[model samples]
Target: MQDTTDFEVWIEDNEPDGYEEIYTLYRSVAEREDNGIWAVTTNGDKTFVTGPTSTLQLLSEKARRTFLNAVEALKSDPEMDMESWYGYERNMANSKA
Candidate 1:
């Protein structure tokens, strides 16, 4: 696995908006079946299974970056809402089909 600290720095620099980019990256990572199960957790401690990963290490790095970015964005934007973030993620998933 890549150093999560490095991934954190990358995410901090990227500062992705909403959940679209992260969600899409996660879905792509999850589609690979050889890796272990991928999961995500929210600040509220809610957890969800993302999928089976073909590249567990890589996906772990991606997840760490994504989650870090999400947390940062949420903190930066006080008005940011989780419902909207989830809705955006769903829409991105739908569009991928």
Candidate 2:
């Protein structure tokens, strides 16, 4: 596993009114599977996972530690486990077909 302690966070500006600000937490390293990028946002009460995506750069030192902690949590999440290894290969294959 990549070092989750070395990740970064980038917050988005110009967020639409009534919507919480969005942030991008990412890591730059050798790609093993998906690019080390995750989207984060809050619903005025607390932070929540907006999902994952690919990112190139814009690493922020201000949010480094916090984002890295979040990355560690995300990495351990069972929901992010590989479908094939979890016995979803047949269903996935059928869906692809």
lDDT of each: 0.42, 0.30
| TM-score, model 2 to reference | 0.22
lDDT of 1 at 42: 32
Give the per-residue lDDT of model 2 (tens digit) for 2-93: 21222333122211111111112223211112222434333332333332322323134334445534443433233643322224433444
Question: How many residue pairs clash per model?
Answer: 2, 0
TM-score, every prediction: 0.29, 0.22
Candidate 1, residues 15-81, lDDT tens digits: the string is: 4344555444444333432222344333332223333322112345455446545443543234645
Runs in model 1 with CA error above 4 Å? 1-5, 32-97
> How many backbone clashes can be found in candidate 2?
0
Q: Give the Å shift of residue 91 in candidate 2.
A: 24
Model 1 lDDT on a 0 to 1 scale: 0.42
Error of 1 at 96 (Å): 20
Candidate 2, superposed: residue stretches over 4 Å from native: 1-60, 77-97
Error of 1 at 89 (Å): 5.7
Q: After superposition, how far is residue 60 of candidate 1 from its true place, in Å?
A: 8.5
